[model samples]
Target: MRLGPGMDYAVAEFPVPEPAPGQVLVEMAYASVCGSDVHLVDPDFHRPEMVGSPGYPGHEGVGRVVASRADGIEPGAVVLTVPSGRFGGCFAEYQALDAGSVIPLREGDDLPHVLMAQQLGCTIAALAKYWREGMRSAAVIGLGSAGQFFVQLLRARGVEVFASDVDAARIAFGREAGARAVHADELAATVAQAHPEGVDLVIEAAGLDATRALAIELVRVRGVVGNFGYPEFQVGTFPTMAAFRKAATVEWFSNAQGEPGQWCFHEALDAIRTGAIEVGHMTEVRMGLEDVPRALAITAAHGEGAAKITIAIRPESAIFEGS
Candidate 1:
């Protein structure tokens, strides 16, 4: 599927991309829609930049390499292809990606759920920089998949986690992840009353600026606000009154910085593959490749009980569907 005008998505076939030197041609088995992909489709933040863009907005994918032009990497290898451009887009059935962009996966590993590592990597990369083993407490705003992952990861580190979301299902997921789940309406007051001094850190996973600002209000004096969510606006102002008053440190969790060695993604994949962390339960929704437009809409709309919406490109016989 390609991005059409006015935030529309329509299916169009493209030729199988040929691998250049140092590139690999992957026949995608599965791909997942991400929240950032939603920002790409929003008219307010879009401008047909990649017109006829082959997978212009998709990045999360797991597939098998059919051909390789790079040394050491071989054909028929199951890999996670994290493409950053049009040629390697995963929304299509095939992706021609740079050798460095593909990470090998164990053959028997469930490919679809492995897609979570792509998003997981983004979170852990930021956490690796700032997360301490025994912080006083942390608040994860926005109980989307990213927020839930933060709650799960933070709780494992022995920190108290307070989470919020408008969706009841996501709030429930946060509770299951061991967080003190609260509705959006009660988040600020709940955490404020509980901690009083504010949380040690705030993981603002919702892309809204309002949430970004709210992170400041919820964070402790001089606390960190790791901005993981993509802002939906092209150009917008942020409320800094809270941040200024709190002497807060706000940082955006950048995915590109995680690309140099791809160590973050590597670690995420290993954790998921080894059962060090569970991502299977997080991938709760599945749809066929043809439903990408609908899938994007569902993902863009935030949540209606959806967690990690997937586009299964291959036949049912190809993947071991989880229970």
Candidate 2:
């Protein structure tokens, strides 16, 4: 597919890829649309150099191994794989992946739907970084796919979670996912009334500059604020002074290059397997590759009513089939 300034996506036939040494060829089963994908499509952020040789733009995909160089993962095994860079190729029918990037799906575990695992991993990493010892109360700003996961994860961890979003439908979805939902404008007061000391941890998953400032405002003094959202535009004014005076810690979480270990991905998958966290509700809309452009448009324009919109690559298969 080619993504340009005035263009959306144009699918074209290409030669099937063959795995090289230490790589695996995956037959993609499902791929989820992410907020960052919307940013990449924006003309302002799109860079000619960032586009790959084959020019595929997907990072979150679950697939079945068609061929592999590794010994443990069988050819028939299902797995989740992410591209090493921005040009990572998950949007295609077949993708070549390094063995290290492939996450093996256990027998009887869901395979086709590993997007949940990928998303859950990101959320768990953020929570693990900022969840505090004295965190009796928590709040998550934004109820997108990741935000919804954050809400469920926090509540599952025994924290009383308060979720806020500009979209009312998302707020309701948060409530359904076990969070006490409130509007973004009303979040501060609502949380203040519920916990005078304020929430101990506030997670900014909305990926908007304004929400970053709101997170700093809602957190208690000496508390922690975890930022899991990737804002498309540069952040103008963060509440630096308030954060400093309150002795708060601001942590940024990204599954991309900055991290050294793959601990978060493993931890997230395990949590889902054990039922410690649930990601079922996040997959609100499921479409095929042909519907990707429309799905992306909906996610970018409509912030609520839909959480995680996944593209089903394998016919008659769930995103996570074995699991």
Candidate 3:
């Protein structure tokens, strides 16, 4: 399915692409609908620049290279792909991608798990620069997939994580991830009473004005606020005076900087491989390629008890064993 000329999309058929020199044709096994993908499809959040865009809608995918004209990548090798403006995207049955954009997966990697690595990689990249040592506590707003991932990542680094979300299912997932889960309405006061000086870090993953504002207010003086969620439109006139008074460092994050070679992927893979970050929870929602329209709609509404919903482009047997 392709993104809209407006707030609409339709399934269109195309001939299977043949690999060009230095490119590989991949048969997609699993592709994930990320939070950003959800927002990008909504009219309230859609960008005019992307109206009538021709590329597919996804970036997180795991698949087998069915044909390769590239040297390093061989036929049947499992690989990863990301969203690229020049190369298009992966929300389809097949994609022919640049060899450089495809990262070979390890032996016995699960398709869905590898896809989880793609989203986790973005979080890892942000933390690489902003997360500091000696930060003992953090509050993650929006206990969705990203928030749950942040909880595990922070805990691995020995930071106490407090999380909040309006969704009960997500709140439960946060608790299972070992975060002290709370309702969004109670987040600020809960953290204030518990830490007094406030948390050392506040991660805004909800992508709402109220939650973003709460993140800023919940951070201690000189603490960091990592804005991981993207709102539908620009948020004009921020509460800068409050942030200023607290001397906060508010950093907006995006995973677009690094591609296949980023250390973030390696770190996330290691965490996954070691079972330090559990991805089983993320695989709760699954569908087939034919269900793309409904999946996109559900994800955009932030409903359907979603975490990381995966589309099975191929049978489960197609997933590599022992991942």
Candidate 4:
């Protein structure tokens, strides 16, 4: 699938990528749309260079290693291949990924739902570096998949998470995930009335200017703000002066910041496997690669009724064999 500006997506048969040295050629079985993908498809973040690139914006996926030029991982291994590049090849039949970007999983790893681990790993990676002691209260702006994960992680640490989003369904998901959830329109007032001093930490997961600013505003003096989502531009202006005035600590990082060892991804997979993170409610998938455009449109609309919009590229409940 080739993506273009203004949500234009076309299905074109492109040549399958070849494995480079230390890379694996994966036969993609499932891929999911991410909040970042919606941002990339917008006219504001369009890149002409990627106009005709196949699978240019998808990064979350699960597949089987069809062949490998790398050691340790071999053919037939089922894995999660989530390349951290600006463009990804998971939307295609096969994507050639660096050996390190693929996390090997069990042959019986749940389909479609297991795909949720890609985003979970991202939240796990970013959160591991920012979470700390004495953070009693938090505000997560955006109850998307990433924001929901952040709320769960924070609540697990005994932090009172006040989560907000424009969508009603997601607000319910946040509440179900142990957050004191609210509608976006009610966030500021609700937070103000509940915590006059503001929350201890605020996570900006919506990546919009207003939400980013709200994260800073909702944090207490000397509190921390973690920017975890992809903004409209590669370069976005922050309320530096406001943060400075409050003596706040701003931690802005990417999900790929510590992806090399795959330890975070391993942790995420283990969590899912052990039922530490239940993804049963997140598995709503489109049938095939041809549905990429609609999936993107639905996700971009923000009322898709699915926590995650995934596309199953191939058939069969069992898509892999133990390597």
The residue-by-residue lDDT of candidate 4 on 26-125, one tens digit each, is 8888898888887776656766677677886788988888889999998888888878746677788788888878888776678676788889888898
Q: Per-residue CA lDDT of candidate 1, range 1-323, in tens?
A: 23445445677888888889999888778888878877776656554566456665678888777889999888778888776522337888887888888888885777767888888887788887667545779999988777877888898888989999888888888998899998998999999789999998999888887788788888899888898856656676777776888888888766542466998888888888888767887676888877888888877677567867888888535532310
lDDT, candidate 3, 98-161, per-residue tens? 8876778888776677678877888887776569778999999887778888888888788889
Worst 10 residues of 1 by lDDT: 314-323
Candidate 2 lDDT by residue in tens digits, 3-30: 5645656556778888988888888888
Off by over 4 Å in 4: 1-7, 43-49, 255-257, 321-323
Q: Per TM-score, what order, best first?
A: 4, 1, 3, 2
Clashing pairs for model 1 are: none
Off by over 4 Å in 3: 1-7, 43-55, 84-88, 235-237, 256-260, 316-323
TM-score of model 4 (CA atoms): 0.92
- Model 1 off-target regions past 4 Å? 1-7, 44-49, 85-88, 132-134, 316-323
- Clashing residue pairs found in predicted model 3: none
Structural RMSD, model 1: 3.1
Ranking by lDDT: 4, 1, 3, 2
Give the lDDT of residue 25 in candidate 2. 87
Give the poorly placed runs of model 2, Cα more than 4 Å off. Answer: 1-7, 52-55, 256-261, 316-323
